[model samples]
Target: MIKQVLKNVGITLALFILMINASAQKVTLLQQGRAVSIRGLSVVNDKVAWVSGNKGYVAVTKDAGKTWIWQQVRGFEQSDFRDIEAFSDKEALIMSSGTPALILKTTDGGANWQVKYRNRDTSVFLDAMDFHGKYGCAMSDPSNNHFVLFETTDKGNTWKAREMAKSPLARNDEAAFAASGTCLNIFDNGLIKSNSILMVTGGSVANMIQAHIDEKKWSTQQLPIAQGRSSAGAFSVATNGKNWVVVGGDYQRDTRTDSTACYSNDAGKTWKIAKVTPTFLSCVQHIDSKIYLATGTAGTYLSKDEGLTWTKIDGGSYNVCIKTQHGKLTLLAGGNGKIAMFSMK
Candidate 1:
C-alpha cells in the first residue's frame, strides 16, 4: 500500500510540472545583436517589416522575421531613430530624437536617405510620429513651454511645424517618452474621417492631449495611471473607434502592478482603471476589435476583453509592439537589438 501511494504522488508531480510549463508563454528570439537597441518597428505585412534604432541602424525583413537586411545610414551614425513609418518595403521614414531633431526618408529601401526635416534647436526632441494616407504628424518634447507639433502633407517628404497656439502648453517637468515611439497616434477611419490625433504624456503630470484635423483647438485631460514622477504615467494609447485604452506605469518600479492601465468608452471625456493591469508598458496596440497587446521592460501582455484585464503572455523585455496593417502578423522589438514574433498557443 505505501509503495502504490508513493508511485501515484510521483505521477501527479510530473503532471503538475508539465502543466506549469504549458501555461507559460513561449518566447522565440528571432534575432539578437548588441549594436542597436530596436525601439521603432513598422510591420507593413506578414512578409515585410522594418526596424530602426541607435547607431543609425535600420533593418528590413521581407520574409517575416526569418531573415533581416541591416544597414547604417551614413553620416548620421550617432542618431537614434526612435520612430518609423513605413508605407512599403521600398519607402519608409525614420525620426530621430534629441538635439538636431531629424526626419529621414528612404525611397530606395535602406540604400540612401534624405533629410526631409531638420531642427537644430537644442530643446527640440521628437517623441513619436503617426500617419494616415498622405498626411502625417510628428510630436516633439516641450519647446518654449509648449509641446511642438509638426505636419506633413506630402507623405513625409516634407514637414512643417504647426502654429504654436495649435499645441497645448506643457506642465512643469511634463513631457512625452521616446521609449516606444508610440506617444502620438492618428486615427482616420473613413466613417469618422475626422483625423483625430491622440498624444499621451508623463513625468510630473500624466495627461492625454487630443486634437482634430478639422479644428485648431487641442484639449488635455489628466489620466488615472501612475504619475507624479518622471518615470510614472501613461506611455501609450490605442483606440478602436468607439473605445480607447492607455497603458503605462512607474517604469522605475516595473514590478508594481497598480494603476498601469485604463480605458474609456465615451471618447476622452472620462476614464476607468483596468481591473487587472500590466507593469510598465512602454507601448500598446489594438490588434483587432477586442484584442490588445502591450509590452514593456517587464513583459508582454494580451487582452481579449478590450483592455479591461490583462495576462502576461511573455516575460521578455520589449520596448515596442506593432501588428501588420494588412495582415495578422504581430512583431515586437526591444533592447540589445532583440526582435520576436508572437504566436498564440
Candidate 2:
C-alpha cells in the first residue's frame, strides 16, 4: 500500500510539471550581432520575413528565421528607416522618419532600391504605414498643426498625399510615435463598405484617429492609456476583426506600468484598461483570436485571452513583434540587431 501511494504521488507531480510546461511560451534567439536598432518587422509568411531600422538598414530572411541577409541602401545610408511593408521575399517598401523624409521600394530584394517619395520639409516625419489588400496608407507626425496622410493603390509603386480636408488636424502636442512602426493599421470587414484606417497618437494626448477608406470621413477618440507628456501615449494599434488593442507607456520610464494597454471589442467605439498590463510596450500585434503579443525595451509579453491579461514570456529587450500572415511563425526584433522567434508549446 505504501509503494502504491508513492507511485500515485509521483505520477501526479509529473503531470503537473507537464501542464506548466505546456502552458508556457518559449523564445528562441535566432540572430544577434550588429548594433542597429530594429523597430520595423514584416513577416510575410513562415518562410519569408523582413525588417528595417536606423541607418537605412534592411534585413530579409527567406528561410524563415534561420538565416538573414542584411544590407544598407547605398545613397540613403544615413537615413533612419523606421517602417517596412513587405509583400514577398523580393518586394518591399521602407520609410524614413526625420527631415528629408523618404520612401523607398525594392523589387529585386535588397540589392536595389528606388526612391518613390521624398519631402525635404524640415518638419516632415513619418510614423508608420499599413495596407489592406491593394490599398495602403502612411501616417506622419503633425506638420503645420495637421497630420499628413499618404495613400497608394498600386502596391507602393507611387504615393500621393490626400487633401488636407481628408487628413485630420492635430491637437496640441499631439503626434505619432515611430518607435515600432505600428502606429497605423488598415483593415476591411470583407465588405467593400467596411474598409477603415486606424492611427494612434501620443505626446500631449493619447488618441485614435479612425477614417473610412471610401468616405474619407475621420473620427477621433481619446484613449485610456498613459498620456500628457511627449514621451507618453498610444504607440501601437492592432486589430483582428472587430477586436482591437492599443499599447503604450512613457518611453522615458519604460518600466512604469500605469495605463500601458487597453482593448475594445466594438471597434474603436469604447476602450477599457486591461486587468493586467505590460510595461512600456512599443508595439502590439494580435496573433489570433486568443493570442496577442507585445514588446518593448523592458521585454516581451504574451496575452492568451485576447488583451485582457498578459504574462512575460521573455526578459530580453525588444522593440517590435509580428506574426506571419500565412503561417504560425512569430518574430520579435529589437536593439543591437537582436531578433528572436517565439514558440508556444
Candidate 3:
C-alpha cells in the first residue's frame, strides 16, 4: 500500500509542474479601463506595465492587463510625456515637454515617481529618451546656439551633458535617442546597421541620414531624399529587432503626410519606403516577430513582414503612447483623457 501511494503522489507533482510552465509562457490582454488618449506605454514583463501622458498622468498594471490603477507621477501636472524607457520593473525614466527639460524617475515600480533630473536653462521641448540598461541618455531641441544631450550613469540619480561629436545637420530644434550606446546612430557616415538590432532616428535629416554606434568602425548609407515628401522632418523613430521605422512629417508644409515611414534591413546602409501610409506616426512595438505601430490621429497599423505591408488595426488612433505585451496591444490616446487597449490578432 505504501509503494502504491508514493507512485500516485509523484504523478500528481509532475502534472502540476507542467501546468505552471504553460501558464507562465502564455500571452494575452485584459480590459482595464476606458479609451483615452495616451502618450507612451511600456510593458516590462507579463505582469508589470506602465503608461504615461500629458497632465502628469501615469498608470500601472501589476496583473498584466487584467487591472490597472491610475496614479499621478510627480514633477509635471500639465506637462506632456513623450518618451519612456524602462530597465526593469523597479526602475524607469520618462521625458516630457517642459522647460528645463523634464525627466522623471522611479525606483519603486510605479508606486511613486520623483524628478531625478531637470535642466531649465536648455529647455527646448524635450522630445525623446532612451537607455542602455541603467546608463541612459536624452536629446532635446536646440534652444540655445548649441544642441544638448543628457546622460546618466547611475540610473536617474544624477545627469550631466555630453559634448556632441560634431554634426552637420543644423540644430534646427531636432530630437534623438538610442536603445544603448551599441545601438546608437550619428546621423552621418559612421557605422552600418546590424541585422540583430534595429535602431531609429529622426528630424530634418529624417529619411536622409546615416548612423553608427562606435565611431572607430564606420558604416555609412543614404536615405530617400526627394522634394515634396511631406514627412521630411522626422519626429521619432523605433524598431522591433527586425526593421527600423522612422516617424515624422513636414510640419513646415501644411500639406504634409500625417506619417512618414522608412525601413532598412541591412542596418542603416540602405533604406526602402514602406508600403503603408502613416498619418503622424508616433511609436512602434514588436512581438513574436510581428511589428505594431502607433500613430497620432492616423490610428494604428500592424505588419508581419517588418513594414513590408501594413493593415490598419484601429481607426483614428489618437494614441500618443502604444505598447505590445505578449500578443496584447495597449494604447493611450484621445485628448479627452481616455485610455484605450486592444489585442493583436
Top-down TM-score ranking: 2, 1, 3
lDDT of 2 by residue, 1-345 (tens): 999999999999999986796456888899888979898899999999999989879999999889999998898879998999999999999999888888999999988999999999877789999877778888888877889988999988889998877787799899999998889988776532465878899999999988787665678999999999999999998887667899999999999888999999887789999999989999998887778989999988888777899888888999999888788999999999999998886
For model 3, the stretches where C-alpha displacement exceeds 4 angstroms are 1-37, 143-147, 166-232, 240-242, 250-259, 290-292, 320-334
lDDT of 2: 0.88
Tens digits of per-residue lDDT for model 3 on 73-156?
654677667666665667777777666567888888767778877677745556555554455656555545434556676876
Give Cα distance to truth, residue 32, candidate 1, Å. 1.0
Supply the global lDDT for candidate 3: 0.52
Q: List the residue pairs that clash in candidate 1.
A: none
Ten residues in sequence with the least summed lDDT for candidate 3: 177-186
Q: TM-score of the candidate numbered 1?
A: 0.91
Winner by TM-score:
2
TM-scores of all predicted structures: 0.91, 0.93, 0.69
Full-model lDDT for every candidate? 0.89, 0.88, 0.52
The residue-level lDDT of candidate 2 at 24 comes to 67
Off by over 4 Å in 1: 1-27, 190-193
Angstrom error at residue 112, model 3: 4.0
